[model samples]
Target: MQRIVLERAGGTPVTKRAHLGAVASGNLEVLCEPPAGDGATIVVSTSVDGYEPVWRATLERFLEQHFIAAAIEINDFGATPAMVSLRLEQALELAR
Candidate 1:
């Protein structure tokens, strides 16, 4: 995972962008950025094309449970939920 943090010297909220995992049939790309006023939000796009509802629900729950303060964009290519979780965790770790 790799991330870039953009912030001034002040204690303002930082903007974070991260890329994790691959773009293969069973990988994902996760990019995170500071939330805009609201709480954590997760948007997932999958190549499979039929799991958006489940992916969004699962990712939203994960973000809320982890108290992640960023907007997450996930580009997934048929990865399972467990794999997605692991990749997300890795990206979050790199962001920190």
Candidate 2:
């Protein structure tokens, strides 16, 4: 049998952009910046009103789980949890 590679080699990091996604209906915008200290900082602002706590909790948990180290600002329109997670991943990937 041939050798198998479980993980690919790492590449040079990229300087991340400031914004991501859209600010329209069913879409959201994410702005990321370098962290001031250790962990990451996530801020969420919604268009349709309320749900601040939910958004905060979800984003906080996502950052914690991923061990991300950046300051992220999310302008949410109406994205689902799954969508938020996926978008966050994408944003971070692009960040790298």
Candidate 3:
């Protein structure tokens, strides 16, 4: 397993919590909640190792567009970048 952490600044705070998707083969899950501090903190645990760059890129792009301040957890099981982005968006939508 690989763990990745990302911190981003300047975003609208998320008021509600949300959970979306599932951590199964070729899939992943997202858990989002109000931030513990200002900005956003994202923690990812993936079954596939050595994919930190990919995970970072995918998350940075999403955050750049959405700009939401929340604590996000992503549990991944061999999920693709597209799926990751989709799940993040869904979770953010539900959270907002």
Best candidate (score: TM-score):
3
Q: Give candidate 3 misplaced runs (Cα > 4 Å).
A: none
lDDT of model 3 at residue 24?
98
| Alpha-carbon lDDT of model 1 | 0.65
- What is candidate 1's lDDT per residue for 4-96, written digit by digit as tens? 222112122335677777778888888876767555656666777566566666665665556556666777778898898888888777765
Global CA lDDT computed for model 2: 0.64
Please give the range of 10 consecutive residues that has the lowest summed lDDT in model 3: 50-59
- Kindly report which residue pairs in candidate 1 clash with one another: none
Q: What are the lDDT figures for the candidates, one per model?
A: 0.65, 0.64, 0.92
- Kindly indicate the candidate among 1 and 3 with the higher TM-score: 3
Provide TM-scores for the models.
Answer: 0.71, 0.70, 0.96
CA displacement after TM-score superposition, residue 40 of candidate 1 (Å): 1.3
Ranking by lDDT: 3, 1, 2
Model 2, span 17-51: residue lDDT tens: 66678977778888776665545656667766665
